[model samples]
Structure formats: structure tokens, C-alpha cells
Target: MATDPDNPPAEVLAALAAMGFKNTYSGGYTHKDRGKVLDLHFQKDGTDLFQGWKAEEMEANMAAITALFSGIGITITPRVMTLAEAYA
Candidate 1:
């Protein structure tokens, strides 16, 4: 069977939920920082899995996510986006 990279495995999602991350639509999830929303998207590159998000918010939640998933061996990749790209 084929699996979608954007949508992580059930175990991963469950693990993340257990760690207090809120599951958003589809493969998206978010962690709140102060009044800001740290958006996350699970993506796949070949057989490797990684999380993608806007660079502006990377510092806000990258460490937390890395720590949370380090034991599980997941990679987090930041996506650079311009203001127009981000807002679009």
C-alpha cells in the first residue's frame, strides 16, 4: 500500500498528540506560542520524512518539535517564503 508523506503515520500523529500538539486539517498541526500560531506540515522526501513550515516561525517551535520527535528520528526542514508567498 502507498502512504502519503504529507499525512504522517498514525503512530506519529498519536505520539505528537500525546505531547500536546494540536492536530489541524489533514497533515497540518500547530503549537501555540504566546498569541502566535506555529504551523507545521509533515512532508516526505523519497523515503525520508520531515516537517516543513515557514522560516519566520521556525525558531518558535523547531526546538520543541525536534526534542519531541528526536527519539523517534524525524527531520524538520524549514521552507523559506517571501511575504507575498507566505500571505498567499
Candidate 2:
């Protein structure tokens, strides 16, 4: 419940960074032209949530997130939303 809101946990940020996501000043991370794939706003309490633009992207990122966080006993939830939902 106590989180930065403007930034993910350092470990999560580092992991995502290692996987090619770049943090932005607006409290989210993006990759290439993929837009914002991860954000603190998507997080729910103890869970780390990821929202990808497409199935392929979500699948790929899910695997990487699982691989990275599962080792440390953290749970990552990956989701896909339409562009409208993503913006709304």
C-alpha cells in the first residue's frame, strides 16, 4: 500500500529496464513504439501489473516478467487492453 506511485519498486524498475523498457517522468515505462506497457497505476496492492498493447507483446513480456520476479517470489500479472482502454 505504500508505494511511490510515481515510480515502481526499484527491483521491478531494474528488471523491466533490463528487459528494454525505459522509465518516463510520468510514472510509466515504455519500449520502442509499444507505448506505456507498465505503470504504477496498474498495480494493485502487492501485485505488479503489466498492460501490453498486443497478445504477442503481452506474452513475451509475461514470460520475461515471470522469469525475473518468480525467482524472488514476486507475482507479476500481465494484461492486454484496447487502445481506448489503455488511454481511459
Candidate 3:
């Protein structure tokens, strides 16, 4: 499997777009005395993921990404953030 060990979340999201995945949302979660945790949400169809040519299999592939990242020392947390504070 091809892997990008040094890829950042924004890059991953861009890659998803390049691969035809649609962007659904972008937001962050607040942390006390720290900063907000950010994420970019994407969604796509999931019928030809293994083939990797169609864009209609993104959701399934994204789920697989979540699982893969989870196993590879990454954590997924769903939370809310204020855009005003985030930009500042």
C-alpha cells in the first residue's frame, strides 16, 4: 500500500479532492489553554474503491482512512470550535 508518513491533514484533504473526494466540512475543537483541534470532513461514493478510479467510493475509503490512521497512532475526535477564535 502506498503511504505518506509525513502528510499533514490539510494535505490529506487536498489529496482527497485530487482523488475526486468531495469536501463536506472543515472545523475544529477547542482545548483549554491550548488550541483547537482541526479536521476536514470529506465524503464520496464507495463502489470501486479497490479500483481507485471512481469518485463514488469516497466515504468507505475515508472510513478505511480513519481506521488506518487510528491504528497508526492517530486519534479522531469530534468536537466544536468557534471560527472567530480559531482564526485569531
Q: Which candidate ranks first by lDDT, i.e. highest?
A: 2
lDDT of 3: 0.56
Ranking by lDDT: 2, 3, 1
- Model 2 superposed RMSD (Cα): 11.9
Clashes of 2: 0
TM-score of each: 0.40, 0.43, 0.38
- lDDT-best of 1 and 2: 2
Task: Report residue 28 deviation for candidate 1 (angstroms).
Answer: 12
Please, what are the lDDT tens digits per residue for candidate 3 over residues 1-88?
Answer: 1233234455555556766668677566555655555555565554565544354454556566676567658766644569987698
Q: Which model is ahead, 2 or 3, in terms of TM-score?
A: 2
Between candidates 2 and 3, which one is better according to lDDT?
Answer: 2
Model 2 stretches with alpha carbons more than 4 Å out: 1-8, 26-58
lDDT of 1 by residue, 1-88 (tens): 1234444367757666665566454432232433323334443222223544345445545676677667667566657689999799
For candidate 3, the 10 contiguous residues with the lowest summed lDDT are 1-10
lDDT for position 15 in model 3: 59
| lDDT tens digits, residue span 1-88, model 2 | 1234445477866666777766443444455775544444322122234443465665676687788878878786756689999799
Query: Model 3 — TM-score against the truth?
Result: 0.38
Off by over 4 Å in 1: 1-8, 27-60
Instruction: Report clash pairs, candidate 1.
Output: none
